[model samples]
Target: MPLYLTALATLLLTALSLGPSFAHVLEAPPRLIVWSPELWREATVFNGQFELFARIGGPLDVAAMLAAALLTYLLAGERPAVWFALAGTCLLVLGLGAWFTLVAPVNAVLDSWTPGPIPSDFASIRLQWETGHMVVAAAKFLAFASIGIAVLGPRLP
Candidate 1:
């Protein structure tokens, strides 16, 4: 019963965390093509507006990872299910790694900018940021699917 509850929590948290990442993925196409000034303005405005998301997403991301880990532990000795749980947890970790390595640096660069001149390498930065989010979104989607399999596979015929 406790294991079932934990698996449910893990699924919910993971799905919630995936929401922002998927939103970013959807935003990337329009974002990637805008003029430099427009991009800069959007980036700055978005940075200002993203605090709420950060506040909500940060904890959810951490909780999802923790919950997935716990689910993996609980499923130990359960064949196939345990493997899926482990894969899900690993994918979440890797998604976070991609964010820190790719997205966060770009964010730091954007955050450091003032209303003055945009950087010469703004395109490169934008591409990296968008690509990073896409990668994270893919990883998170897979993680959610894997965790779903972990929880439900055993019950299915």
Candidate 2:
């Protein structure tokens, strides 16, 4: 029962954490190609909305990582389930690593911007940010799939 609960929690948290990354990926096509001024305006406006996501998402991401780790442990001796859980946990960690290394630095720059002239390097920064999210989304999607397989795969007893 505890194993089942942990598996469910891992799946739910990982699925939820994918939301913001997926949102960024969906918006990247249009956002990436827009004029600097337009992108600046959109970025500033969109940045405000992310406060809510940050508050909710930060803990959720951490929770998902922990849950994946826990699920991996709980599934020990369960053959392919344990292997899949381990893969899912590693993918989640990889996603978080990409977020910190790729996304957070650009976020710091974006957060520091004012209403004045957009940075000359805004395009590069935008590219970094968007690409980071796409990478994160891919990692997270794979993590979710791996975790799901762990939970649903045949048990070895």
Candidate 3:
């Protein structure tokens, strides 16, 4: 019961945290791929959008998963539940580590990237980093969503 409550709390928070990013994204001006300046701005916006899954909100997802796995462990007396918790913990730790080592520094760069008269080299790097950010964001979202469904889907009754 405690685990279920904990998972729900985390899910609610995740939903809350992601809401504004989605809102900003939807309201953003349309862009053309050929326009480098516009692309730069779009890149910046996309980078900001990536924040939800790569930051602490992501850890919340893992924590929720761990809580659910532990709940299963406690209730069912099953080895799978224990395994799931351990797996989820490891995933979260790795995700956190990757965020610190790779993504966070790039995020700082993205934050500081002013939106005027970008150099070709700067644009290239920005695009590359932006692509990487998207990849990580997708992975994190998938992890969170899968864990959520795995834990909560069955309990939806």
Which candidate has the highest lDDT of all? 2
Report the number of backbone clashes for model 1: 0
TM-score of 2: 0.93
- Give the count of colliding residue pairs in each prediction: 0, 0, 0
Clashing pairs in 3: none
Which lDDT tens digits does candidate 2 get at residues 53-124?
689888989999999999999999899999999999999999999999999999888877777676788778
Root-mean-square deviation of every model: 2.1, 1.7, 5.8
lDDT of 3 by residue, 23-80 (tens): 4334333322444665656655555655654465665655554554554455354344
Question: TM-score for each prediction?
Answer: 0.91, 0.93, 0.53
Which should have the higher lDDT, number 1 or number 2? 2
Compare candidates 1 and 3 on TM-score and give the better one. 1
**Candidate maximizing TM-score:** 2
In model 3, the Cα lDDT at residue 101 comes to 63
- Look at candidate 1 and tell me the lDDT of residue 11: 100
Clashing pairs in 1: none
- Cα lDDT of candidate 1 equals 0.87
Q: Candidate 2's C-alpha lDDT?
A: 0.88
